[model samples]
Target chain A: MSIDWQPFLLTLQLALATTLILFVIGIPLAAFLAFTRFRFKAIPEAIIGLPLVLPPSVLGFYLLLLLSPASVFGHWLDTWFNVRLLFTFWGLVAGSVIYSLPFMVQPVQAGLQSLPLSLRHASYTLGKSRWQTFIHVLLPNIKPSLITGIVLSFAHTIGEFGLVLMIGGNLPGKTQTASIAIYDEVESLNYATAHVYAAILLLFSFAILLLVYSIRKKLQGSITGL
Target chain B: MIRINITKQLRLAHENTQLSIGTTIPSNTITAIYGPSGAGKTTLLKILAGLVQPEQGAVEVNGRIWLDTARRVCLPPQQRSIGFVFQEYALFPHMTVQQNLQFAAGKNGDKSYIDKLLHLVKMEAFIHAKPSQLSGGQQQRIALIRALVRKPQLLLLDEPLSALDDAMRHELRTELYHIQQQLQITTLLVSHDISEVYTLASNLIHLEHGKVVFQGEPQQLFGAASLSSTLQLTGEVLQVIPDGAIYTVEVLTGKNIIRVTAGEHDIAKLQTGDKVCLFVKAYTIALKKMNG
Candidate 1:
């Protein structure tokens, strides 16, 4: 029994890709939640925040049902792009986005909520649109929170288990990630390889967590933080 | 012409409040809303800035109806060309002084104009400095110029000088006056600081419980007609009247009869409502401006 390096590299890529995608989508969503006020706002907030307390497998199971050909979203994507999501690498990204959305949102909501309301009002009086103000003013002010969200998302994706297992379906080299690889090693009684992969995941997640938290602390202190 | 006739129902302390403040705010002159705390002064300013909506009424500035509840024509703050200087300065802490001003200017202003604006507020030396690095006075200067760089049609200052010390306030008030004159922008200032209001406001709007109790020149409110429960009046003995402690005396150029506290001076002055000067502490006065 030997340690497989491919699974570790694959896990890194999956987490990186997931983190990047979460950033592209989550940052703007967070900006939206931070500013605009309309009727029934709490409903959308509760929906975005639902994943926080939800069971990972339940979330994965729902995604599985929703991504099937029977679902409207699934049929739309399949009709337009000829893509089947379940049991694939793309499926893992989809699951990761839902599973880790709160990790992306909570920090950002805190950042925006903590900011002085005066800045927003001042922006309004200066003749800037909500989008423009968020891009120009709110985003920069909440840099620490954004970075916190990004790094946390990356680390979280690396360490995640149930959702990825349910969605990625553990197709070796194609969809199987290091997390699954480590589990595979343990189940097959290859304790040596299991320990190796487990150690790397542990170290990687630990380092990312430390870096994110330390950077967030530095930002709080410096005030020169971007 | 800026015609503001707003009647709002606000729930300040959980009860619905009704307020009526009607004024043709003078163009290119500073109109300060002067009152005590919780007087709905800030609320009035917010309605004008489009940050707060009134239950009823409208704000017409430069012939554009910013808010009209009846017509349902409510223009957002971003659509109106007004500059608001928050009491805290509220400068974008992340951006440098220059970027703060640039953000205010939008797309039409260039770097040269920005440079000139920084120079106008005497913040050119710290143009690249972040707001966190500046002192209170310096930050205020940057905030003032940032609001001005946009060339807004109107300017709003909410306790704009309350953050600074005596010396800094003296200097900045001059700077504010100088800038407003240079830009010729109509302004509405809100401050509870009595001295600040008396020093700066060309016109005053006094509100109590969300209603306009007084609106007009500052000099008009300084006299003795509108005395409330809080302020007591003292005057030299105008008479030795038996009916109540009624003293008739001179107040700033007008003569009025007021209930007076009997003292030795009252017993010594010319009897039968004599001509003596009356003095009223500012805190005791509730005023309404007479039609000019």
Candidate 2:
């Protein structure tokens, strides 16, 4: 039986979109969580970290309810913005982003926190603004964490099954990612096709993890040399 | 002139301490904040640099209001136009020496000034080197020049030479003095080394438990003049050789190993590693060349 490339392509697209969006939003969120001091910081921290512990199906179930047309937010979006998020490619992307948020955030936050406070203070004393310091000094120094965040977010999104199942619901060419395609093949007794999908994912994940580890080793060496 | 009167509540490892200080640092002079560990010397420097906010205070540098609690005006470190060399140097590890200095220099920063500063420290050859590649002394020199790149009105050094070995420290101390003299910038130095304060600072603020116990000339504070015709020196005791009634005590003071005679009463409490104050009568002390 010939393998359909559509699911793999859709998975790549979703992973890329989710990883890009997460990268854009995650750095600032991580910086805030790492640097800011407030009375209720743990509340937001806990909320962001919920996906790490919450079952993917449970999280997906709540997300499905939140994005359904019957919900106020979904109804508001449908009426005002004319945008639908449920069972769409964008919906899958959103679900993946939420599902893999802590994967991106925790590493970046830990990296930022591990840095010396004087590095930021020194930049400030030299008349560098907060944004400049963050972009030029702080971010550059935490290269390993940034890599980990990006790679983990991408890989996690690609490997996602339960959340996509709950939200995207195997809509071929729209949201049926490789993981879902593999599940469909298994249920339909297409063991050969399922083997193809699972093998490719396993290899892809290993390569990504190997890249992260090697890059981390090199960065750590350079940092210690410094 | 920099006039500062600030109070901060510091939470240290074991207990909380209040840092209450009021002092005027004359412009174009090096003023040393002499204190024991955990006396809030570093905190005071940070306060002046706008890195640490005091509970209540006013910092007027050259008549520019840096911080005034009454008016709720606290300028951030960016607007303060001050140079601060942290104890760890705080050089950006990712950047080259040239980039670090250029970053501090800003858009209008003079390229020649960067070259000149490097030349002054004899680190021009290593301009393209990163901070990690440099030795402790080299990193410190870069840190010093980086601080001066913007031509700041106030220069704050928090134990800038504390990390160096004795020889490096001495070399850098002289280099620091020359640089400070050449620029004539108003500087606040936090140092526990008495010899450093004596050699470099014109004014001294002696802090204890985060309070200014004394503020005056280093000589005035350290010079024990109550006993007229007496010379005072602080040193660590190295050995106590008992030669009958009188004990020959060897003290390591500054770079010198001086031997003084003490009686049984003085030798009773003294040990190998005890810090002691040596008081010599003016008439009894003599100056002689090493060769002679």
Candidate 3:
């Protein structure tokens, strides 16, 4: 029995897309959480961090409701953009991004917050604009954290099960990811195919995680000159 | 002239206090702000550099109003062409020394000027190395040049050499004074070391408990009057003998006649029977004119 390649390929696509979107959105959000001094800043911060502790199924259920055509936002998107989010490939991506939000945000925010304030102050006093400082100074300094965030977000989205199932369901070649494919194969008593998918995912996830840990260790050593 | 009149409320560990500083720093002069820790010296520098906002204040630099709290005019740091050297040498760790200078140089700055600055500090060979690879003294040299890359109208130095060794500090102090004189950029330096302040600053502002306690020449604050209050002895110049370039002055401190070697500049105006105060600093004795 040969393993189906569609789900594995789709998993890669979904993870890549989600990670890319998160990279764009996470940097600004993490910067806001890291730098701003508003009184009620903790409210939005807690909201972004809620995914870390909340059950994936619970998050998936809300996302499902939010993406359904019955909802106002869902209806507006469908009416204006001719798109339906529920059970679509983009729906899987949307769910995965939310499910893996903390994986991307926490690391970047930690990196930004860890930097010395004088770094930015030095740039500012040199007549650099805020964006210039962020691009030239802040981003270069937080590279290790950026890598950690990207790797974790990509790996987390690839292995996600509950949130993807709730929103995207198990549609062949579109939304059915490798994790879901493995689950379906096992339930159908296709042990050979299930084992193949599981083994590949396990090895891939292990290697990716090992690479992240090694990179982080190397960065720490270089940073401390240890 | 850079005129600054600022008041800020500060919350200390136990009490709420106010930092009220009002002074005018003359253009093309190095004004040193001398104070102990927690005396708001750094805060004053930050306020002048536009890093910290004053509760109620107005800062006018060369007729340009940088900040006026009552008028709701506050230009951000990016708009102020001010060079600031932080105590920790806040160099961009990821960039090499050359890149660090290039980043601060912006578009209007040229490569030749960068090379010139690197040459001036004798750091040309290490320009390609990152800040972390360099020693503390090297990092400060890079930081100093990075600040000057913009040719800012005002330079604020917050104990820029506090991290170096004594030898490096003295060497850099002389370089700093020469650079300041050559550029004639109005500068404000914050230092706790009396010798460091006296060496570089022509004018001194003494801050204590967040208030300007004294503002005058460095000599007035650290000269004979202040030295006599510390470890100083009153003496009369009994005899002055010139030995080659050095002058050996014999001072009669009551019963004892203390022999002190003085520089030609210090002994030029001294003659027999002139009252003087001898103060020893760093194991070297120096004479100052005594007040009646």
The C-alpha TM-scores of every prediction are 0.82, 0.91, 0.86
Pairs in steric clash, model 1: B226-B286, B231-B284, B237-B266
Quality of candidate 2's docking, in CAPRI categories?
medium
Clashing pairs in 2: A226-B132
Candidate 1 lDDT, tens digit per residue, B1-292?
Answer: 6898888776666566676778788899888898767778888889999999888898999888898999999999988888889999999987888778888887787778788877788777897888888989999988888888777888889899899988899999988888878887899999876666777778888888777788888868764454444443434444454545443333222245465555455556456534455444565444698884
Q: What is the overall TM-score of model 2 with all chains considered together?
A: 0.91
* Descending-lDDT candidate ranking: 2, 3, 1
> Candidate 1 A-chain TM?
0.90
Cα error, residue B188 of model 3, in Å, equals 0.6
Task: Select the stronger candidate by DockQ from 2 and 3.
Answer: 2
DockQ of each: 0.51, 0.72, 0.49
Please estimate how well model 3 matches the true structure, expressed as its whole-model Cα lDDT.
Answer: 0.90
Error of 1 at B15 (Å): 3.9
Candidate 2: C-alpha lDDT: 0.93
Full-model lDDT for every candidate = 0.81, 0.93, 0.90
Of candidate 1 chain B, the 10-residue stretch with the lowest lDDT total is: B246-255
Model 2, span B102-167: residue lDDT tens: 989988989998998999999989988889999999999999999999999999999999999998
True C-alpha contacts between chains kept, each model in order = 0.84, 0.91, 0.82
